[model samples]
Target: MKHILALLFLTAASVMANTAHAENIGCVSTTWRVVNNDKVCVQSFKDPDIEGVACHVSYAQTGGISGALGFAEDPSRFSISCRQAGPIVAKKPIPKKQEEVFTQRMSFLFKGLNVSRLVDTENNSLVYLIVSEKVIEGSPFNSISTVPLMPWGTQAPQFQLK
Candidate 1:
């Protein structure tokens, strides 16, 4: 029974691991703080479950003794932009409601950056929303970007909604 439980746990983890991951593209200095420098970090990520869409996010990162040590909680200020990178195709069904596509840790604990995706069937677009989350408090700040179904390399995507 223990081995079976472990296998189930591993399977669940592997399935959930399809979440999108970001690559650190660059950072720009924002302010010179004590013991370190505050800056904005730019990250790029591709949709893990969806094809032909890429997103770029820029957010502020606190820099100081605490931040340098990975203890500071990043502010809830970020911008997102997603564009069509290639021919969009989905063999499986996609959700019409918002679904989480990515999550990035901004602190040692209690804070993270998340991106969600929603297929706008009416508008024939894919919407991506980025937000910051805290364990105790909720954030109202978020950014959204959309990629409309359009021509790519002489072929247009036939969006299928389920």
Candidate 2:
């Protein structure tokens, strides 16, 4: 029995360590409790790898072992928001379909929030998309923000496949 307990302890520790590392390298994970004390604000941050384009994402966390094992019956509920907190300059205008800049899991059951950056070529603007998803259904909670590329002399070149 002792051996079994020790092995389980080791396994749990390893899983937790990997989760922490995954959350740190390319993203930031944080937890904030809801005012009602029934849910937590779990957020993940992913900065655009491209220079001059900065993005941040925050989302809510709902269901977890706490609710499953600790007698907390209510699943966690969340809200998400994203913003371009800096000057928007593109080394090159990113493609519309290839615009998913960041993604993070919002729950253990395959729910997630994704942020994508789209180039509105006709309007000469940049559009940011924030969407929430789950395994069975997607949340209607979606938001969009746009930044119009100004009259700067540097024009974005059209993308072409080599």
lDDT of 1 by residue, 1-162 (tens): 799767855754553486777899999989998787899999999988778899999999999998899899888889999999999876567878888888777777557788999988789889998888776786999999999988888887846666
Weakest ten-residue segment in model 2 by summed lDDT: 19-28
RMSD of each: 4.5, 9.1
Q: Give the backbone clash total of model 1.
A: 0
Instruction: Please tell me which predicted candidate would have the highest TM-score against the true structure.
Output: 1
Worst 10 residues of 1 by lDDT: 8-17
The regions of model 1 sitting more than 4 angstroms off are 1-16
Global fold similarity of model 1 (TM-score): 0.85
TM-score of each: 0.85, 0.51
Model 2 lDDT tens row, 2-51: 99767855754453433212133232324344332333443445334333
Residue pairs in candidate 1 whose N, alpha carbon or C atoms collide under 3 angstroms: none
| Shift of residue 91 alpha carbon in model 1, Å | 4.8
State residue 154's C-alpha deviation in candidate 2, in Å.
Answer: 10
